[model samples]
Target chain A: MTYCVGLLLDAGMVLLSDTRTNAGLDNIATYRKMFTFEDAGERVITVLTAGSLSVTQTTIARLREAIEDDDATGETSIMLAPTMLKVAEIIGNTLASVREDIDHKMNATKVSVSASMIVAGQRAGGAMRMFLVYPEGNFIEATEDTPFLQIGEHKYGKPILDRVVKPSTSIEDAQKAVLLSMDSTLRSNLSVGMPLDLAVIERDACRVSSRRRIEAKDPDFARMSEAWSNALREGFSQIEL
Target chain B: MTYCVGLLLDAGMVLLSDTRTNAGLDNIATYRKMFTFEDAGERVITVLTAGSLSVTQTTIARLREAIEDDDATGETSIMLAPTMLKVAEIIGNTLASVREDIDHKMNATKVSVSASMIVAGQRAGGAMRMFLVYPEGNFIEATEDTPFLQIGEHKYGKPILDRVVKPSTSIEDAQKAVLLSMDSTLRSNLSVGMPLDLAVIERDACRVSSRRRIEAKDPDFARMSEAWSNALREGFSQIEL
Candidate 1:
C-alpha cells in the first residue's frame, strides 16, 4: 500500500515516495521511506522503498551502518561504491538479505516479507543512472526508451507517466509529471496517503540538487493539484465521443 | 485478463467489455464477455463478466438454459424474476454455486476457479439498477455516490471515471467516459485487448437501444482515442508545475 516513482531524464532524475504504511486497515502509520546518501559533489544516491516496512527499514538501516563503519569500502558501502551500478548492487543485496532474514523468521507463521526500491544517483565523472531493484537482489536500469520506474500501487498513476515522460524531458517538467502522477494515485487509493518526499538530482552534479517534503495541506501543492484536475476535466469535455 | 465496466446514470445505463481471454501470455483468444437478455419492451438485462472463463461461461449458459426452461419460475429464471434485485440475486446465486462446483472439481490440483459479474437492466415498471456480483453470491448495487462498477484490470482506467462519472451524467457523456476509461486500460494492459462490446439501454426502453462492437481497426474509435490522447498531452503541458 505504497506508491514511489523515479524518472531518469536527460537533464536529471526526479523521485517521489508516499509516507503511509499499514499493518492492516486499522493499524495505519506514517513512516519515511526515502533515504539519501551524499558525499556532496563526490557522490549522491537516493533510495525510495515500497512494500514491507520492516524489510525496507532494516535494509536502509544496514546500508547506513555500512557507510559509518570504520572499515567501510567501495564494496560494502553504497556511498563509497565505485559507480552508480555498484551502489545499486550493494543496496539490492542488502535488501534481499534483510528480506530473507525476516521471511525465514516469519516462515513458521506463514507470513511474508518483501520489498523493492528505486535507486537513482550518480558519481563524479560518471553517467547519471536510475535502477529498479527487485526483492531477489536483481535490478534493471532505466534507458532512453523507457526512462521511468515505479513500484507499489502504480497502475492508477501509470497512464499519465506513459504519456508525458521521456528521456529528453527537462528537470522541471519531470518534477511536475511525477507530482501529478502521485496526485492521481492519491485520489484513487486510500492506502497511499501524504505527506510525500521528493528529490531531484541534476545531471553530473553528484548531489541532490533539490529536496522537498509535501505535507498533506501544502498550499502550492494543493493549487497545482486543483489546476491539473480542472485541466483534465476541460480536456475530457472537449473530446468527441 | 479482462476489463468490463458498467455505469448507471439518470439518462440510462452503459456497459463495455473487452473480448480477450488468456490461459497465459502465449495462449490468448477472443471470447465475448458481454451477454444480453431481453423480453423486448418488457425487460432488458446485460451482464459483463471477468475472471475464470470456465465459471463465467458455464454460469451464463445455465442462466440462458433456465430462461428457456418450461418449468422456469421467478425463483429459477432471471427473466421471470419479479424485480431487478431478484434478478441480481438469481445471477449471484448461480454464479456462486457454479464457482463452488468448479472449485470442488479442481480441489485435488489446488487450482482456483472464481469469477465476478456486473449486472445492469430495467424491468417494465421498475427502476434501472446495476449490481456488482461477487464470487461468494453477494452483490452490491451502484448508487448515486458511486455510479459505476468495473472488474478486471480496473485500476489503470479508474481515475478518469472517479473524476467524470456521476448519477446525473448524460448517456452520451457516459458512453464517452467509459470508452475513454477503456482506452486508458488498453494502453496500460496487454491482457485487456480490442474488439470491445458496448451496449446502451435508455431509461424505460426495456431493451438495448444501441450496441456496437469496436474492432481493433475501427476508425471512429481510433479517432476518439487519438483525440483523447492529444487532449491529455495538451492538458499536461498547460498545467503549472
Candidate 2:
C-alpha cells in the first residue's frame, strides 16, 4: 500500500510519493516509489508508482535498461520518446508486460499483481504534460477540468484537492496542496507511512527543477502538521450551534 | 455504494448517511440507508447501513416487521429489547442472517450480499453507546477514546476525525464534523451522492432526538459548502512560499 500524488498546474507538475511498503502489517519497509529520467537539455520524465512492489520494481528496471541501450528507439525507451504521450506509452507497455507476467504466477496462489503510475514531464519541443496510467495500460491526460491525479490510499486526501486545487494553481501552492494531501493520507492509513519524496518540475525547465526527501523529523513538515491540527481545531470551534 | 457515519458524544449521538445506491455506475438510484427504531422513553436505535443494498434493505424490513408485530416479544422485536446492546445484537444477527440467505441465492451470479452497520443510541437506564457491526454479526464498541464509528466511504472524511473530534465535542460541532466528512466523500467518489439523513440522539433523551434530511438544494449545507471552499482558498493563499 502507498499514497502517491501528482499535480499538473499551469506553473508545472508536482509529484510526491511515500517510501513505506508493507507485506502484511508486520513486514513494513521503506522503498522509494519514484523514478526520474533526465537527458539534461533533451527530456525530463518523472514517474510515481503505487501497487505491487515486484511489478513496479521490475517495470522500472526494464525501462532503465531500455534507456541505457545504445540502439534504443522511441518505442523502446521513455528517455528518447518524442512526446510525453509516447513516454507514457512506453511506461504503460512496460508496466502492463511486467504485471501480466507476475499476475499469471500470482494467480496460482490466489493473489493479484497490479500497479499504476502517474507519468509527468516534458520533451525538448513538446508541451509540459501529465498522465495517469492504469493497471491495464490505458492512460488519461490531466486537463483543466481536473488538474491532479492521485493513486493509492487516495480517499483520505482527496477532499483538499477537490476544495482548493485547480489548473491555475501556482507551483508553490501546488506543492503545498500535494504535501497536505499526503499528510492526511499518512495520518489515516497505516499502510502509507513517512519519509516522502517530493519533486517539482517547473514549466518548460525540461529537467527536475526541485527535489527534496522529507525524513520523519523534517522541520517544515512538522510545522505543517502542527498548523493543520491547529487549523482544524480552530475551524471546529468556530462552527455554530 | 453509500456513505454513513455515527458519532457518540456527551451532548448526543449524531448519525449521517447518504442516499445514493448503484448496482453499476449506469444503474444509479436513491435509497435511504438510515433506519430508526424507537419506543418513546424506553429505547432508541439508529442503524446506518453500507455495502450490499439488498442485504440492508431486507434486514431493515424484517426489523421493522418485528417492531410492528402484534405479538412482539423481546426475542422478536427491537422495540421490546431491554437494552441498546440487545437491540444491536438483534440487528447484527438479523443482518448476518439476511446476508447469508441472499449470498446463497446469489451464488451463481457472484454478487456479494454482505452489509455492515453503525448502531448508536441509548436505552432507558442504560448509558448511550455506539457499535460498528460487521457482516459476521460481531461488533465493536466506540469508546471515549474513539467516540465515532463510520460505515462505507469512511476514508474521505477520516482526517478531520483524527485531528478535531473527541467525546466531549458538542453536538453542533459533531454535526459539522460529519457534514464536512461527507462533503469530502461526495467530492471524491461518484458512487456516493445525496440527499443525506442526519440524526442526533441526546444522551439520556432515549428517543430519536433530532433528525434532518439535507436535500441537494438545502440552503444550510450549500452555505457550509461555500464557506469551506472559501476557507480552503484562503488557507492555501496564506501559506508562504
Candidate 3:
C-alpha cells in the first residue's frame, strides 16, 4: 500500500508520497513513487504513482523513453502535449496500456494489477493543474472547487484535505496540511511508512522549488506528530456531551 | 455503509455506531446497528454489526430469540452461557451460520454476503471485555496494547483513535473520542452518514449507563464540528514546515 497526495493552490502545488510497497506482509520494501519531469523554466511536472509498482515503474520508464525519442508524437508522449488536459490524456493512455499488458501476463494467476497516478505541475506560462488518473485510464482534474487529489491509502488522510484545502490556499500552508495529513495516515496504517518525499512547485515557476525527504525521525515531523496527538487529546477532553 | 467502534478501557467499554445503511449511492436509509442485551446486574452485552445487513440483522434476531426462550439451554441460548467468552463463541458460531445461510441463498446470483460484529460489555464479576468477530466466525479480543476495534468505513475516522485512546482511558473520554472519530468519517465519506448511536457500560455495572443519538443538525455536534475545523486550521498555521 502507498499514500500519495497532490495539492494545487494559488501559491503553487505540493506533492507527498510514502516509500513503502509490499507484495505480501513479509515482502515489504521501500520504493520511491514520486517522479519528476523537469525542464526547469520550461516545465516541471511531478507524478506520484501507486498500486502495482510494476505498472507504474514501466509506465514511467516508457514516459522517460518517449521524452527522449526525437520522433515521439502526441500518441506516445506527455511532454509534447498541448495542454495539461492533453498531458493527463497521454498519462492515462500510458497507464492503461501498461496495466492491460501486465494484467494479461498476470492473468494466469488471476491477479489484478491496477495502478493510478496523481499528476500535477505547470508549463511556464500555463496554469498549475492537478489530476488523478484512474486505474481505468479515465481522469479527473482538480477544479477550483476541489483543488487537491489523493491516491493510495487515501481514506485515512482525506478528512483533513476535505476540510482545509481550497484553490486559494497558500502553498506554505498546503505543505503543512499535506504533512499532517500524511502524519495521520502514517500513524493509523503500518503499510504506509516513512522516508517520505515532499516537493513544492511555486505556481508558474515551471520548476520544483523545494524538495525534502522526511526520514523516520525528522524533528519537524516529530514536533508535528506530538503536537497533533496533544491537540487531539486536549480537544477530546474539552468536548462535552 | 457504517462506521462502528468499540473500546475496552479500565473505566469500562464504549461502543458507537452510525445508523445509516445503503445498498448503493442512491439507496440510502437508516437502520440502528447497536443492539444491547442486558439481564441487568447479571450481564450486559452490546453488539455492533456491520456488512451484509441481512446477515447481521438475522443473526441478531436469532440470538435475541434464544435469549428470550423460556426453556433456553446452553446449546440454544446466550443467557445460559457460562461466561462472556462463551457468549462470544455462540455469537460467532451463529454469525458464521447466518452468513453461510445467506451466502447459499445468494449463491445462484453469485453474490457474496458476509457479516462482522464488535461485542463488548461486562458480566457480573467478570472483567469488561471486547471481541471483533470476523466474517469467518473467528474472533479476537481487545487488549491493553490494542484496546479498540473498528468495522466498516473505519479508516476515515481512525487517526484520532490512534492518537488518543489507551487502556486506562475513561469511559467519558472514550465516548467523546469515538463521536469525534465518527464525525470525521461522516465528513469524508459519502457512504457513511449519521444519526450516530453510542453506548457506554461502566465497569461491572452489567448494563449500558449512558447512550446518545446525535442527529445531523444536533447543536453540540455542529459546535464541535466547527470547532474542530477551526482548531485544525489554527494548528496548521501554528506549525512550521
Candidate 4:
C-alpha cells in the first residue's frame, strides 16, 4: 500500500509519495513511487503511482523505454506528447495494457493487477495541468473546484486537504499542505511508511525546482510531525465540550 | 452507512453515533442508532449499532420484547444480565440470530443482512466494560491500550482517536473526543451524517450521567465544529513548512 498526493496550485504543482510497499504485515519493503522525466525547459513530468507494484513498475519501465527509443513517435512517449492530456493518455494506455496482461495471467488465482497514477507537470507552451489517471485508462483533470488528486490510503488524509487546498494556494503553502496531509496518513495507517519523496515544480518552469527525500529520522519532517501532534493536543484541550 | 464510536475511559464510557441510513445515495434517511437500558444505580447498558438497519432494528425490538416478557430470564434480557460481558453476549446472540434469519430470506438477492454493535455500560458492583460485538456473535473487549471502538465509516474518524484517546482519559474529554471524531467522519464521508446521539456513563453510577442529541442547528455542536476547524487552520499556519 502507499499514499501519494499531487496538488495543482496557482504557483506550481507539488507531488509527494510514501516509500512503503507491503503485501502483508510481515512482507513490507521500501519502494520509491515517484518517477520524473524532464527535457529541461521543454517539458517536465512527474508520475506518482499507487497499487500493484508489478504493474506500475512495468508501465513506468515501458514508458521510459519508449522515451529512449530512437524509433519512438510523439504518441509513444510522454515527453513528446503535444499536451498534458496527451501525456496522461500515453501513460494511461500503458498502465491499462500492462494491467490487462498481468490480470490475464493471474485470473486463475483470482488476483487483481491494477494501478492508478497522478500525472502532473508542464510543457513549454502549454498550460500547467494535473490529472488522476485511473486503472482502466480513463482520467480526469484536476479543476479549480478540486485542485488536488490523491491515490491510495487517501481518506485519512483528506479532511485537511478539503479544508485548506485551493487553486489559489501558493507553492510554499501547497508543499506544506501535502506534507501535513501525508503526516496524517502516516500516523493513522500502517500500510504507508517513511522515507517520503517530494517534488515541487514551479509554474511554467517546465522542470522540478525543488526535490526532497524525507527519511525516517529527518529532523525537519520529525519536527513537522511533532509540531502537528502537539498542536492537535493543544487544540483538543482548548475546544469547549 | 453510519458512524458510531464508544470509549472506555477511567471516568466511565462515552458513546456517540450518527443517524444516517441509505440503501443508495437517492434513498438516504435518518435513523437513530443508539439504544439504552438502565436500572438507575442497579445497572446501565447502552448499545451503539451500525450496518444493516433492518437487522439492528429487529434485534433491538426483540431484545425489548424479551425484557417485557413474563417468562424473561436473566440470560434473555440485557437488564437482568449478570455483568456487562453477559449483556454483550445476549445482544451478540440476538444480533447473530436475527442476521441469520434475515440473511436466509435475502439470500436470493444476495444482499447482506449483518450488523455490528458496541455494548458499553457498568453493572452495580462490576467494572466498566465495553465490547465490540460482531455480526457473527463473537466480540472483542476494548483493552487499555486500545480504549476506543468504532464501526461504519470508521477510518476517516480514527486518526484523532488513535492520537488522543487513552484508558486514563477523563469522561468529559472522552465525550469531546468522540464528537470531534464524528465531526471528522461527517466532513469526509457523505454516508455518515447528523443528528448525532451521545451518551456518557460515569463509573459505578450504573446510569447514563449525560446524554445529548445534537441536531444540525445545535448551537453547541456548531460552535464546537467551527472551533475545531479554526483550531486546525491555526495549527496548520503555525507549523513551519
Clashes of each: 0, 0, 0, 0
Error of 2 at A153 (Å): 1.0
Better of 3 and 4 by lDDT: 4
lDDT of 1 by residue, A129-168 (tens): 9999999999999999999999999999999999989998
Q: Which stretches of candidate 3 lie above 4 Å from their native place?
A: none
Q: Mark the 10 consecutive residues where model 3 chain A has the least summed lDDT.
A: A232-241
TM-score of chain B of 2: 0.96
User: Model 3 residue A93 lDDT?
Assistant: 89
Clashing pairs in 3: none
Model 3 Cα shift for residue A148 (angstroms): 1.0
True contacts kept of each: 0.77, 0.52, 0.62, 0.69
lDDT for position B88 in model 2? 83
**What's the DockQ for every one of the candidates?**
0.83, 0.62, 0.67, 0.80
- The residue-by-residue lDDT of candidate 2 on A183-219, one tens digit each, is 8898988899889999999888899999999999999
Model 2 stretches astray by more than 4 angstroms = none
Model 3: per-residue lDDT, tens digit, A1-241? 9999999888889999999999999999999999999889988889999999999999999899998899988676777776788888889988999999999999999998999999997786788899999988899998888888899999989988898888888888788889889999998899999999999999778998999999998998898878776766665666675
Clash pairs, candidate 4, are none
* Tens-digit lDDT track of model 4 for A1-241: 8999999988889999999998879999999999999998899999999999999999999999999999888899898889888999999999999999999999999988789999998999999999999999999999889899999999889988988899998888788889989998998899999999999999899999999999999999889889989999999999998
Can you write out model 1's per-residue Cα lDDT over B1-241, one digit (the tens) per residue? 9999999999999999999999999999999999999999999999999999999999999999999999999999999999999999999999999999999999999999989999999999999999999999899999999999999999999999999899989988899999999999999999999999999999999999999999999998999999988988888888777
For DockQ, the strongest prediction is: 1
